[model samples]
Target: MRAASKKRGIEVTSISRPIKPSDFHDFDLILAMDRQNYEDILNSFERWRRKEPLPDSAPNKVKLMCSYCKHHTESEVPDPYYGGPQGFEKVSSMMY
Candidate 1:
């Protein structure tokens, strides 16, 4: 991922972390890479909301990352970890 981004002149500095309920309050948008992730985020939010109320609009902030892709027909970004270098390249190309 770093190599791909660096090739495009983008600095890949961010670390990967698991999503948390607090993210609902911290970020304007939460993009999930796939349907499972999207559901997981909503489920997490629902569980968190039961403990403390969040704005009704919080769920709306979560979205499928590919929904924003104008050129790709893929509904989800496939996990590239098992796809090897070519798979990583394909997913990286979809980023923009």
Candidate 2:
């Protein structure tokens, strides 16, 4: 996929991985790709906070990626897993 995209002047790569607690402490901003991801990241932070209480400012660290957009058409980024190529293209355009 990366090679195919690169051929077209679009560079896309996958760095998919499970979100970790240290990610919260490590990065100032943690943007979730979608709602489920946002919820999961919040839940992960809750668990991490319980184990090793973070600063009261911790909750402010996470946010939905779409929130950064100038025109907020969607509250969350839609998952394209079950859809066709157009779905993926839409998300790519939204993210871009």
Candidate 3:
């Protein structure tokens, strides 16, 4: 991922972390790369909701990342970890 970003003149300095319930409050939008991820986030939100009250818009904040794509018809950002270099490039292109 870092290599792909560097190739595009983007600096990747942030460490990866799991989504937290608090993120719903912190970010205006939370994009999921794929269906599994999208479902996972919604499921997580449900679990958190049982513990406390969440914003009514919390569920709406989660979305599929590729839904914003203008040039590509992809529905989700593919996981590049197993596809090697080409996979990363494909994801980078979709994001761009």
Candidate 4:
């Protein structure tokens, strides 16, 4: 992930495991890479909603990665785990 971001001249900061809302309190928004990833994060957040001692009106902070697109991207980058170079090329093209 560092390599990919750097290759595009994109800077990134990392987050530790997000087990608590306070862990992400300083972050404005969370971005999930895809549907499955979004679902996983949503599930974790749902549990937090029930168990964490959060404020009644804390700001909402989660979103889809593709929603941040506008510079060039218009949709989620499909996972390339089963595909080859052509698939990767597609994702790269979209981001650029």
Best by TM-score: 3
Find the number of clashing residue pairs for candidate 3: 0
* Candidate 2 vs 3: which has more lDDT: 3
- Candidate 3: residue pairs that collide: none
Question: Model 3: residues >4 Å from true position, as ranges?
Answer: none
Weakest ten-residue segment in model 3 by summed lDDT: 87-96
**Candidate 3 lDDT by residue in tens digits, 1-96:** 888978988888998799998898999999899999999999999999999888978999999998889979989888899899999988887776
lDDT of 2 by residue, 1-79 (tens): 3443454578876667887877777889989978889888888888888888676676698888999975558878777
Tens-digit lDDT track of model 1 for 1-96: 777767778888898899877888899999999999999999999999999978788999999999999888999999988889877778888895
Q: Candidate 1 clashing pairs? A: none
Q: What is the TM-score of each candidate against the true structure?
A: 0.92, 0.79, 0.93, 0.59
What lDDT score goes with residue 76 in model 3? Answer: 80
* lDDT (C-alpha, whole model) for all candidates: 0.89, 0.75, 0.90, 0.63
Candidate 3 — what's its lDDT?
A: 0.90
